[model samples]
Target: MCGTEEEMREVAGRICRNYLHGAWKTVEPQALGFRRISRVARRSVLRSNSFTMDEPKKVLLRIYGQVHGERAMDAIVTESVIFTLLSERRLGPKLHGVFSGGRIEQYIPELSEPALSMKIAEKMAAIHSMDVPLSKEPTWLWKTMGKWTRTVREERLSENIHGKSVDFEKEVEWLKKFIATVESPVAFCHNDMQE
Candidate 1:
């Protein structure tokens, strides 16, 4: 529904109103500065997947897709939960609001690459070690990759009618076997790590 930053903020304000209800007046609306901090790529096309809103308060807004579509929405739900938990534990950004396309989160200040990498490693280690209960079963790595693999196959076929077909079932079997061979506890991971 929202096509620009102003529109996005307006939608967020509406959501905040619904979330706060009678208490909405407690917080002041900030004159936010919007920037395309990052984007989530789909089929080689970049989408407004992530944006940073700065000023009185800074927050990272993640836009959600319409449906899971074999596992897409599943990933968002997973990330949202992870963000929520991270906020609660003070491990990641604070979660502000949630809407159709995405949710708002606290904006951590930028750091240099080396510093950022170190912090991320430390934070991820903490997340991995914590015994937190996720809302749903974490979709195993293999399943997530399989979804992308399937999408690639479909696109390949669609692009060229005579493209060599991929043996999806065989690929799935291989993925399962590969995943089975791994001997480590699976942790909730930010599969889409760029943002």
Candidate 2:
């Protein structure tokens, strides 16, 4: 997002300083994996994954990288709202700060216990039960897929989307029909949910 690793650090350091201040002036954040969530946004974990602050003792932090693509700014704003809600619910890390290019989020520590699966299911159920001020109809996915299909068609890359030939228009129709058959009640779902 920042074009290079050095630039990424420079940007992240500035954002971190704006929030955490003091110690950051001395401590350089170690790099973790830079993972891409979508074409629009990128996120990288600053491992110390355990940054120590005078007030919080030790904490974790993440920097949401520069966002691009059409309507990307709107997407970031929407995501920030939902993310803040989830943080308030204790389902996610607290959003420390949000800036133009990205935001700072509390880092979550690694969780690896045998009961993790059960705990995750409980959390997901809670998330599903919650009401969010958004559309109730489960149509956003279809609309997004439709947009992706159009983009693919424009690029003339329709043949490789499914690892084989596919008719974008027909596939969208098939998906609409198939999804309509399932009784998926509307709720606050994560973007990463699968059918």
Candidate 3:
């Protein structure tokens, strides 16, 4: 986390400049012509990373990082991987470049809240309808959940709270069996919608 708003802006600007320059260096001789990014007002659903627009290039840059001890739940998949796939299908923003902890993407201007909702629903349906890549691995949801369940069970057993009889093993087994019975299909989803 940054100590101040100014510090955050400085960091974002550096990242954005590096990304754009690196991406264009080989092809374009002209400088990036970057100006300072104007910070947008934070909303409930927005990530702590400030939204900035490139006036010269007409692009959007998103700087990703930990905020208030919370990190993105991109355990098995990274944003670059997901966004690249979505970009190929023209389902999401066009990715201009990716940095170490952030990415520069084509920015769409925000619409009114109600109109945004409608657009999001339509886009999500379109995204879900796309065929998964033949080379991509299966969804990691179930595997990650099962791993967490075991870890929780181990922690509880280690704590040994008195008068608490918890059969986590049985619970996990039952949960897995229950989940197997359900017809939940793995679809392309923006797991972190708040971003």
Candidate 4:
């Protein structure tokens, strides 16, 4: 139900009060010294006005939740992992403070377009240098291929589009053969670079 402006303001005030009253005790909000500048579709750009944080720091923050849950304990583990990795490589944001509260990261305001591109390219190169062994286990590959084939089959069965019959087994076989042709010593590849 919709409410008058005053009523809506009261509701918002109540919600904020509840939050301030330790309703979300486990996850305390901490200012990261940054603000979201703009959002276009699914992409968002965050700007930091302080001198300590940079684009890389924001990237680290963005991906933090991917490997970790939103809970406080999970945040601790994730932060530790991030710090360890960053320290090892000597290429991460400076850790300002840590606790049950959210992280306080240093902020950097401006970056030249060319410098940003170079920084991104360097990060990409570093990531691509990491070693990832190709799976030699045939059973796993067969299982994965089987699952994919089944999914495609189900989709085809549901759709009304009728034309030439698709030989799924042949397609799966071709895919398997194609995958086998890929040389080993695979490096981490991030196809999506737009932030």
**Which candidate should be chosen as best, given lDDT against the real structure?**
2
lDDT of all predictions = 0.57, 0.63, 0.55, 0.43
Comparison by lDDT, 2 against 3, better one: 2
> What TM-score does candidate 3 get on C-alpha atoms?
0.61
lDDT of 4 by residue, 148-180 (tens): 678878787523437557777687789878978
Assess every candidate by TM-score. 0.62, 0.68, 0.61, 0.43
Which has the better lDDT: candidate 2, or candidate 4?
2
> Of the pair 1 and 4, which is ahead by TM-score?
1
Best by TM-score: 2
* Candidate 2 minimal-lDDT segment of 10 residues: 32-41
lDDT for model 2 comes to 0.63
What are the runs in model 4 whose C-alpha is more than 4 Å off?
1-88, 91-112, 132-148, 157-164, 167-169, 182-184, 190-194
lDDT of 3 by residue, 71-147 (tens): 34443245578788888777777776776655667655573377887987787888767776533443365566666
lDDT of 1 by residue, 1-195 (tens): 346756655655555445433333233334323455555421111112223332224445555545646667766767777778888998776666676666656556564477887987898888878776764454565676777677877776534446665666577788778877988666656544434
On the 0 to 100 scale, the lDDT of residue 35 in model 3 is: 34
Alpha-carbon error at 133 in model 3, in Å? 2.4
Q: Which stretches of candidate 2 lie over 4 Å from their true place?
A: 1-10, 21-54, 57-60, 112-117, 158-165, 193-195
Name the weakest run of 10 consecutive residues (lDDT summed) in model 3: 41-50
